[model samples]
Target chain A: MYQIQTPYLLFLGDAPDQLAAKTARGINDWRPEKVVGQMSLENCKADLGLPELGLQEAYDKGARTLVLGTANRGGVISAVWMDVLKEALHIGYDIANGLHNKVNDIVDVAGLATQLDKNIYDVRHPTEQFPIGTGEKRSGKRLLPVGTDCSCGKMYTSLALEKEMLSRGMNATFRATGQTGILVSGSGASIDAVVADFMAGAVETIAPANEDPNHWDIIEGQGSLAHPSYSGVTMALIHGGQPDAMVLCHEPTRSHMRGLPHQKVPAIKEVLSLATTLAQIVNNDAKFIGICVNTSQMVARDIEGYLKKLEDEHGLPACDPYSQGTAKIVDMVS
Target chain B: MYQIQTPYLLFLGDAPDQLAAKTARGINDWRPEKVVGQMSLENCKADLGLPELGLQEAYDKGARTLVLGTANRGGVISAVWMDVLKEALHIGYDIANGLHNKVNDIVDVAGLATQLDKNIYDVRHPTEQFPIGTGEKRSGKRLLPVGTDCSCGKMYTSLALEKEMLSRGMNATFRATGQTGILVSGSGASIDAVVADFMAGAVETIAPANEDPNHWDIIEGQGSLAHPSYSGVTMALIHGGQPDAMVLCHEPTRSHMRGLPHQKVPAIKEVLSLATTLAQIVNNDAKFIGICVNTSQMVARDIEGYLKKLEDEHGLPACDPYSQGTAKIVDMVS
Candidate 1:
């Protein structure tokens, strides 16, 4: 007889007790973990004991999946999952593990990073590759190789060269796995070196691939790269297909940065209009939705206040990172 | 001074003159193409005059982009675009390239395929490769290289591979153009040869990597391995993110196919219920919807009567491909 596997679900929240209760109700047959409540990335990492909480521990405890319910932090919610562990770790100021006795799946709620209208920083940085701890400049070439080690120490390489080609503006996108790699270049030194670097722990960065002024639109109260213009979102949606739910980010506009003048309010409003337009486009089925924005842009008193405003005004669930620990907790559990 | 570019749209119909005018009025400020009402894969080739429709023709005649609106024949409606006219001989299709004259620099339908839950087939056939059409078995190594000449004399190996993968139980639900190709192996030689035969022309096949069936759920009444399960409705939703309409194919159950002696109908209520469930799962949106069944599985007259009854009872658009010329047209075009 084939038994249906039960997937794990993770949820992050500011109040562990309330979140635990809500989660138990949502999934039936789940036991909620105790809340640690530290509430920040740094503090959460410390409380969770990052290095010690590695994959092995969760696997030993019989976890199969996880979910992160980021608390009502200022605006952002962070969540991550190690498919093998099936365990979720939530982050606030502190980290808490084992949200459920046995996690087999996840429900992600970390909102997207909204594009501010202007460039945040254009300072001339060095070209050298930066170390993990130091503030050194990381060379793009060194960081991205064909077969590099992942942070998890897994050796991986994409069979398709589309990523490399995209990096060189040769084409728009690329996706690859193992077998396809052999046919493309027939195991050459340069290809091997590229593959090694890729496996060595290359970072996947999503930046503006093209420069068309009209492509920029505003979300929340700042200017940003329009939803359609962003490569990561486009790629994810295209490859993953329609997700049951999506989290949108509405970070502060570039004009509102610390050094910029405050007269750009009207411009910021225009950007907000664009955000609403994007939300409308994606909100077709009313699937679970959430938004995130920096406090510096909208100046909300708390994360819940901001979320409430978004819900009332745009029929969206919005939050600010300053007061919401949602992203942190979500990240830990996920 | 930079002039804003307006998007182009294409419209096709049975009564080209009348439907074109109606479409123009419905869309507001749009032109229509008049051709014999034939919009199948094979007929599309003829209708578009693919051989003669060169890049210069596309650019000069302002037919680079198009929107097709054929009569909702046999429950299927399709729209595609001529995105990039690389040269007179080569062309590319993008979801964003609607029938409008103006083109948007940024693609609006980047991940549109995820929504429809469908499979995309390569333009060329598997037999296109063994041009002598001898169907003789040969050493797999003897086959042409990656970018070899296909029946169309085009290099679309990735596409051919995608088709073969689908046949071999790979759920290659959707695909689009990018810089590189995603390759798979580890199956066997015969399988590899079949895959190679499929991707003779296209550059890449965008679909989910063939996954272990143990990880997925198998829903029924779609199609057989020969035709495969390429749900048009699913494809539309996934490719466009938001779909304008959908068409579903509902095959009869095994009991119905055997034609055992029975008194009155065998309570087809279950079949109709299953079809509705499948349709809803494939396309959540309640928009234009249609259903089709293979003639071999059920008596066309009886099935038509039952479908009409269902349509009247449920207010759903239930149809079979018995009377319409759409399927015939598709055969002609392909």
Candidate 2:
């Protein structure tokens, strides 16, 4: 529910490797114009290939926010990074943090921000009190990507669809629901971090009625309906987004549900069927327009055959949103 | 995860009428031995028919907790009630509040409880970090009371089933998931108040695996799957509770979903079929053992006929759990 001000000064605070700065790289890649430059602490191993600037220099260069774009091993902002964060705040920059350890929880840093009347956006924790969803049909179109299990490529597919639609001159916006997605998109709530009663309401708030009837809101999905732990979030997204069209995302190499070895990944067919039924509760026209497979783990030669089989079996466009672009999938929805 | 210490001193703080004290009445009716006595401030109109007692007197009478069991217009703990709460804490009674306004939010009361080394449970707020549900089969038999809409008697059916099973010398426990149910049962988490990711995990924690293989955990269900506003909570309960048997609870005269004028109540057959399919994700043998109808709005003669029609249509025992008892339904699972 926190709206972050940008162009952002990305802080790659002593990241051990390039992977630790993946969130930073994502922001620079997606919204390059909104990114001012990168800042790195001494001993930082990661680089975003942008000019490095100090807090004052970045602020002078039109950076309004200091984004903690890199992750440490513990997902915490180390004590050594406090001085830089405070300096950024003093330079009239609002801070946007995507760490497990909240900037708002640190007494000194939070108090300083309060004294300066500056905003500190803790993206993982929603500060808004959301109402119960009314199930009222909103104007405009919605597309959601439902998955067969957690970490099976729902977010990737959603981003891909939004990119493809934009390239095709379609009115579409990416609605992020997770931490990395929120940082990448510059605005959106972390849906899974919300209170259980408000999950659907948060989705409704993020993807509200649009005045443009032809506009598409590509809402990012969360857990799978077959996931024992996270299906609640998935269901909330289905009901709240009220998607007119959906894309089933699956990982063919996943032998089990994420983080649970005892639980098997639900079959793609079952997830698609259940997702359609649930989504139709609010939107009678809800249907799966395509299947997005994460074939990163499969042999390169087998990828085409597997996708062909999926398209034949489900009677929908099937593609790997990454290696193969979502142009084919976008053709259906557009 | 806050365990309420009882025999409780029920606090009916200046309730306007008997209905305002419904939660107190429920607690007294379900757990009479746990009720030490009732306490009221000046001009309080509602009474639980228990002897009036002051803070010290109730403590001396073996009351270990002071339960704020009444509802005010705004669901807040009024300033006038603060003295009584503080006095109870001074007298060594832990506090259990079911108000929408949390007791822990009142600095004076919560601080004193902490200083005195006592507990003040804000029952509607969960303080524990619950793990994501594992979907692992637990060693026990469990029954869930699902519904066609919110507030359609899922809690009442669960209580009734627990009562019937216990009376029949069957090992049973009622797992509460809401405010009133928590007060009545004395030891259960408010599942809806939990973080979205932990909804199912909270259910699993409350109705955990038991050493007694024959033990029956009657988990109270939350919102209906067909109700667009809250089906996520329903999905969480289904996947988390993993009940072997489920009793469908519905209000026969209701034409629409609760709080939503535009949405119609789902049909019994549709709801049962959907519930069974979803519940099977965690519990392969999940089924509807019976139907619990709230026929309060129907005429006495029509109630029997309506129930007969339900039983004949669904091939399951049907009854008003309050009026006719859950004997037939329990017989199926027993």
Candidate 3:
């Protein structure tokens, strides 16, 4: 009876093809037990089996490490990886962010020690051995501050509340508080109808234009830089002080005369560079550096490269639309 | 001023705290994003900046509609997916299995199609349309015949070789003539030492020891099972028919163990039960089903209730360990 030991590598991403190629190379070069496995957001539904079980299955199959590709948001794919990793490694968002940014800095011993926590290394490592802070403070028994902003102008504030309902396989109401502005040029009914339709779904809060601050934020802040349309108000939200993670409503396709020309690649570079600089300034205290942009702008490669480069260069942990899928999944579950 | 759009989501896992509260859930219930963006795996990798790009990246990114998972001797992952669905979405596999499986399924899709095919689709309508198969004939590019067995007791085959190699960013001297099996393994040593340490890396392919013939197959009529006591094998190569994609070796794990004294959970019931029953069949076409198991097995939930009672049980996916740490960084370059 030979016990299958978990491989030492884990690949996380939204690109399965890239993962496959990378895994093949790793197998040819390093040869772990298994090189690649696949999972998706749609698969996280109860009917399809949630992400937690998907990860466990991989581990049981003798995967010591795992790799996840960036998953799409609409399909709800990437969130699955977060569910599994949190369960398996006792990894939290802060830890995950840490690992995602400074994985190279984690030594084999640190990896093992982090896994063992206070049980094994408490007496030995002492000062350096405490569990790395996840930047989360436990409120009672709950993992406080469970939800995050969607960058789409949605915020997930309570995982416990949401998960409580979801465990029973029930859909929960999602709330979007604060205010963001939006300007509609269409007929009053058309604009009101559109707003009403958008607010019809499980959204708990939808402030009218008068109260929405997103417009002012975008107009006065970074959003103005991202888009310089001379007119039209849009929804916005304060992203817990981290402007990058803030969500902006209103379609990006809207023309912004006198606004910055839509040079997506360079813009993405600018955002990522900003994140890197912020990460450098904030050091390890940075939780997640998020940038919300219109999907129509730059190519996927440009965004991925910018994010990867940001992580590689500044050691800052940032989350964009690509990385958010998996991160969201973990946030929901943890 | 191109507005860059990125997809993002969040999920929760069955952490001790969450599980203790019986709050394990997924993201479906949360109203996160209504229409998320999608991109091809190639584009995603280009975004991530992976060198030596290949077809697998497309699948990993969920770009391909038809992706394959793991396979067994004389079995192809794509074929298996096809066996399950009249028209599979995307076929995903490691470089080795991709080549071997692609060859085995040569009659279905063209070799060039296997290499050049892009099965990108919207996750919302995964099976909306089937990709047109490439009609190229088998050009004897495969070094190993379909179902060819090795002396060590395993099957050999091939899949998308050129795409695989290009994806990994490797240049190699490949020959069409040989009775040799390519062993895929990696050592801590640099690339220069791979050929020198080749023999030392050869090891027997091990799965669970069972008498069920239907669940297993031999390559070239050679038994695929190895000795139960074998700890590790140097390497085993499945002959990929394509010149580009060839897998050197694969390591099996304890998760494949059959009839283990453990109760089945509802999440894994469908696949695990199928695997068990199929294992009993003397020549079932289903070779492998993706099974991902992580530390969540430690959860004290009512496994029976969860598997049987839940209308839709959440399950895990298989694991790929080689994507961890700097190795992932190396993958970007490769």
Which one is best on lDDT? 2
Better of 1 and 2 by DockQ: 2
Q: For residues A1-334, write the lDDT of model 1, one tens digit per residue.
A: 0111222222233333443333223222111232212122222311221122333344344433332333323433324323212222221111112231112122321111011111111001111231111111122211111000011100111111122233344322221111111112111111111111121111121111124321211100111212111111122221112112333444433443222232122232333342232222212221323444445545444645656766677565455433442342123212
> Which scores higher on lDDT, 1 or 3?
1
Which model scores highest in DockQ? 2
TM-scores of the models, in the order given: 0.22, 0.95, 0.16
Q: Which candidate gets the maximum TM-score versus the true structure?
A: 2
Question: Which residue runs does candidate 3 get wrong by more than 4 Å?
Answer: A1-225, A230-236, A239-306, A314-324, A328-334, B1-334
Model 3 chain B worst lDDT window (10 residues): B226-235
The Cα local distance difference test for each model comes to: 0.24, 0.89, 0.23
Q: State residue B201's C-alpha deviation in candidate 2, in Å.
A: 1.7
Q: Please give, for residues B1-334, the per-residue lDDT of candidate 2 as tens digits.
A: 5567889999999999999999999888888988989999888999989999888888888999999989865666677898888888888988888888888999989999999999988888878888878889999999998898998889889999999999999999999998889988877888888999889899999999999999999998999998888888999999999999999999988878999998888888988988898999888899999999998888888988888899999999999998889999999977
Interface RMSD of 1: 20.6
lDDT digits (tens) for residues A1-334 of candidate 3: 0111234223333433343233223222222223334343342221111133245565555545443223223433334444544454542111111111222233542464366551111110111111111111111111111111112222221222333335555433222221111100000111111111121110111211223222111111212112211000011111111122222211233342122232221233443333322222212232332333333355766765655564565454334332243243233223
How much lDDT does candidate 2 score? 0.89
What proportion of the true contacts does each candidate reproduce?
A: 0.00, 0.79, 0.00
**Which window of ten consecutive residues has the lowest lDDT sum in model 2 chain A?**
A71-80
Q: Which scores better on lDDT, 2 or 3? A: 2
